[model samples]
Target chain A: MERSIRSYSPKDTHKIGRRIGTKAQSGDVLLLVGDLGAGKTTLTQGILWGLGGTEYARSPTFVLVNEYPARLTLYHMDLYRLNSIEEIEDLGLDDYLYGNDLCVVEWADKAPGYFPVNHAVVQLEVIDDQTRRVTVSSETAHLDRLVMAIAGGADE
Target chain B: MSDQDIALAIDTSTRYAVVGVSRDGQSIAELSWRSDRNHSVELVPAIQRTLAQAHVSIEDITVIHIAIGPGAFSALRVGMSTAMAMATGRDIPIITIGTLEIEVHPYLDLGQDVTAIIGAGRTRLYIGTFKREDSLSNGHVYLEDRDKFLENLPVDSIFCGEAVAELRSELIGRLGPDYKIVSAPPPTRSASVMAEIGHAKLKSGDTTDLADIEPIYLRSSQVASAARRWPNTKTE
Candidate 1:
């Protein structure tokens, strides 16, 4: 249900991303939590790249959500500016999360109420400017193993 | 033209701005504000928030549909400018909606004839008629000058817009109950309505170039605001 990870640098963070990307599914919802510049965006880039061979998987904060049409459509969402829970429904967001696309949400904690129930929650805790601890939460056994593998493989 | 696109609707045409409305025709997701001209600050965040809220992102938004005018020059400029800018940068096709029509829609009736107008100046007006496009679909709007509008007025045209009440006596005395006046909501220029109209046009291969799709300024604006000209703002 819940697993944890640690990363020493950007490359270590990306290893966490690669495992998630390799294991992501069409209806999977990945909720990333971290403070400002905790390498959440860096992890996202790795996940998006691994999932769909995409080269661009930025924060998508100012631009809202960015979609890449590759092997599987990857939806990247940054919720740093969200106001109300209705803001989620207004944009028709769940359509993608429930559809045939992989969803990654940043600052998902800001809204607190809108995250789907079965989503994988990634919590990044900064130990120093260069070191970070990441935790994953999910119910599916497959994903639990994937998270374990990635967290174990990460040589932070 | 032969594709099902990710239709986008941005409505920053008022004090209350809408970054990107849903493909659905029901409730709208609006970016509300008071006195600040904060579209620059609110727009992208609103878009991102709305997109994340819906669980989709900008990439899911294939067709950039936006409101053009019948609103504040700045707010109106926001949706169009942002849409055009995105279309240009992303190489996506753009869909333009009539700002006045969206505003006047809540007041329109299929059973009764209707005339939609945003104010021009003096007695002259920026008038457009909503002739029945179909039984199920909303009517069409011919955004043009008053004389042309008056000439094409559908039988029993009920007038409602910014200055319709101002011309109420003249219009009523002239057209009677057949052409009455009504009030409309400010966020009326919905991307949903535009999607309906634009769909027909788009299906018939009637789309304009992304660069050519500009605002539909019903008339050369007077010193008054869109609320005065159209109902894109609150009623005075």
Candidate 2:
């Protein structure tokens, strides 16, 4: 169903994201949803850090996708500026989506029709200047471990 | 000279797939399998079983040959990436050939120009034409649109490839009296042909740098270019 976690600071938010990143595996699709300046990019940076990615996690807003060399390839996509479904399909996203790596998409609400039937969604809300409430949900059991990893620690 | 000097060839350039082993210009084992679109899953196991049947281990492979293709992009990637990994790990030499070249090889010395065509997708074909004389020398395969290629067919050229059968009616309909449409004969032994070519190349020291191997895709993926089209947009 859904699980909620509260982060009092940026570090706490990063820690949670990093935990999920460490636990991520091939064919895992992460849907990040939030408003502007809602710490989405910061959470993604933490995810990349945990994945052993060497490059700085840059916003893929204009480019749509940023690929990083990691223990497993990291495909970070931003659907904020993608206007139409045809444009999104023309990108041939299946090559990266079905690939044997982790795929993280920001502002995924723009292209909901093309999303896989099973995926994990993370919703971030700004409670205050320094606080954020994150909710994670999925239909599959694999998401339980990811949410648990984010709530507890990566070790357990 | 022996099992230690054996070479392995893998081709997933088309729907029909093959894994073969050769030594000193002689094919030791040629394994053919059917795949709809599961190259990634079937390829490794096919290699393992084929090598085992040939009584050769991965350690005995001295060279890895693959078809760096102008075929299906995903299939070509699976073949090239796998071959590169295998060659890199063992420090073995690699020989790269075009997928169309494999189809054109059997008819290379037939004293006629040849155009190899493979199904790219619905209503489109990956067609490459080569002058047999030129193919034997500084090989240059040209990828062109199917309709354009048919309209510009040269006189006395022989057309052949795995997809030739399916396109036979279309070819006959488009061609004139001077052109000859020769559909590729059944029992496609493309993998064997690949191994033979590879062995010949290896003896002549025409191996490819493993780092420089890449698939020849005629159509662009367009993701990067599309993204760059709107750089001034405010996105967060």
Best by DockQ: 2
Model 1, position B191, has a per-residue lDDT of: 49
Model 1: CAPRI class: incorrect
lDDT (tens digit, per residue) of candidate 1 on A14-110: 8788877888876778888888788888998888777767576777888878887656778888866666544554464644554556788987765
In model 1, which runs have C-alpha deviations exceeding 4 angstroms? Answer: A1-156, B1-4, B14-16, B24-36, B104-112, B119-126, B132-155, B161-180, B183-185, B217-236
Off by over 4 Å in 2: A1-156, B1-4, B137-140, B176-179, B185-189, B220-236
lDDT of each: 0.63, 0.75
Q: Which window of 10 residues has the lowest lDDT sum in candidate 2 chain A?
A: A147-156
User: How does model 1 score by TM-score?
Assistant: 0.42
The estimated TM-scores of all candidates read: 0.42, 0.58
- lDDT, residue A137, model 1: 81
lDDT string, candidate 2, A1-156, tens digits? 788888878787777788878988877888998888888888888888888876778899999999988877889999887776556755756556655678999987665535654579888899999888888888889667666666663223
Kindly state the number of residue pairs that clash in model 1. Answer: 14
Mind giving the per-residue lDDT tens digits that candidate 1 earns over B1-236?
43465556676655556554445332234343432357877787777776776666677666676777554445567667788888887787776666556655655555655566654322245555665443323545433445555555556666676556555666666666555566443333444565555555555665559758766543222212322332121111
RMSD of each: 20.3, 12.2
